[model samples]
Target: MERLYQGIVRFRESDYQSHKDLFKELGQSQSPHTLFIGCSDSRVVPNLITQTLPGELFVIRNVANIVPPYRDTNDYVATLSAIEYAVKALNVENIVVCGHSNCGGCNALFAPEETLNAVPHVKKWLEISHGVKEKILREYPDADAQKREWMTEQMNVVQQMKNLLSYPYIKERYQEGKLSILGWYYIIETGEVFSYNKESMEFELVTDTFTP
Candidate 1:
């Protein structure tokens, strides 16, 4: 806690002061170009990874970067509300769902519920990706444990992209070419990022191709 306070002081004295004008402009209003949805992993810092400053990307981080299908009920209201506001109000041109390597939420998908006994709410939240687990088991029955985990992480990103489409406003904007939904896989060990190609149905390195 003291460390955080010290960091705040340093920011006020340095980074914030250096970017005062930009922050001042942002104080009035923000017009971010992208809505970045990423995992809650401490290792995955969206702004740091993307090298984006404040007001550039509106970010939402959650366990495994999961996005539940649009529902009429109030469940998952925080995430749902952010998605709606980003699309309908902010009119963000791009929505990126980024999943990272070795995600605990993705690993939890294969673990027995009892393994998550201490985090019951987390267990419940992970159920949103149950279909991803089922699809992997059905299609890649012979895959090894490491392979399964990697596949689950990548597939979850694609699944969330589909979930984003369930929102009417997002769908309308997407169909009109006003919005683009992207899936990204980030490898933490190597600092490499892969973007999903809808045409090839494969995740290619961002350095190799520019789909978004």
Candidate 2:
């Protein structure tokens, strides 16, 4: 808590002061260009990673960067409401679902039921990625541990992109070419990022010549 307070003090005295005019303008209204859906992992800071300024990216972080499929029921209302507002009200042009290499949520998916019994809610929440696990097993049944985990993390991002499409308004905008959905994989150890290519159905390094 002391560290957080010191960081706040630094922000108020230095970071905020340096960007006073930007902050002041943002106070009036914000028009972010992208909706960044990323993991709740402490290592993955959306603003820091993307080098985006305040009011640049409207972000929603959750376990494994999961975006539940659009449903009429209010099971995951918080996440769903944020998505609705970002798309319908804010009209963000891009939605990026980012997943990291060593995601605890992805690992928990393969843990024994007894191990996850204590965190029932977390266990339930991770069910969103069950399909990813199934797909991996069906396709890469002989893959080793490292390969499976990496694949799961990447596939989870793709799955969430599909889930975002389940929203009618999002789908409409996407079809009209007003909005784009992107899947990104961040490698924690190497500090490298890869963007999913729908055409090739593979994740290519962001620095590569491949266009999305």
Candidate 3:
């Protein structure tokens, strides 16, 4: 907390000072061009990874970066609200859902055969990984540990991307060509980011997408 406080002080004194006009303008309103949905894991930071400045990316972080499938029930209201506000209200053109390598949340999907001693909320939250696990079991029934981990991490991105589209507002905007959704895998150790192409359904090196 102390470190965070010092960082805040520095931001207010120097970082904010350097961008005084931009901060002042953003103080009144924010019109971010992208809605970055990512895991709450400390390692994955959309702005830092992309070198985006403040007021540029509207961020939503959650355990495992799970966007639950759209539901008519009360459960999806919060996630739906953000999507609606980003697409309908804020009019953000891009929506990026980022996953990462060595995700603890994704690992726990097949781990801990028993949950009696685990945190209840965390267990519930990680339930989203069941789909990924099932896919692994069915597709690679005899896969070894490394294969399972890699596939789960990969498939989890696709499942979550599909879940993002389940919202009516998101679907409508996508159909009208008002929005675009991107799935990404940020490899921490390599310091490389790979983007999953929807049409190709493959994670291609981001080098092809951006030069700088």
The best candidate by lDDT is: 2
Those runs of model 1 whose alpha carbons end farther than 4 Å from true positions after fitting are 74-76, 208-211
lDDT of 2 by residue, 88-189 (tens): 999999999999999999988899999889999899999988999899999999999999999999999999999998999999999999999999999988
Tens digits of per-residue lDDT for model 3, 1-212: 99999999998999889999999999899999999989889998888999998999989888778887777765545666786787788989998888888887887888775752466777877776687888789989999987777678878988988887788888888888888888888988898988897778888888855632
Q: Give every collision pair in model 3.
A: none
Give the higher-lDDT candidate: 1 or 3. Answer: 1
lDDT of each: 0.93, 0.93, 0.83
Q: Which ten residues in a row have the lowest lDDT in candidate 3?
A: 111-120
Tell me the tens digit of each residue's lDDT in model 1 across 1-212: 99999999999999999999999999999999999999999999989989999999999999999888898985658899899898888989999999999999999988875788879999889989999999999999999999999999999999999999998888998999989999999999999999999998899997745645
Q: lDDT score of model 1?
A: 0.93
Cand. 1 TM to true fold: 0.96
Ranking by TM-score: 2, 1, 3
All-Cα superposition RMSD per candidate:
1.3, 1.3, 2.2
Error of 1 at 185 (Å): 0.4
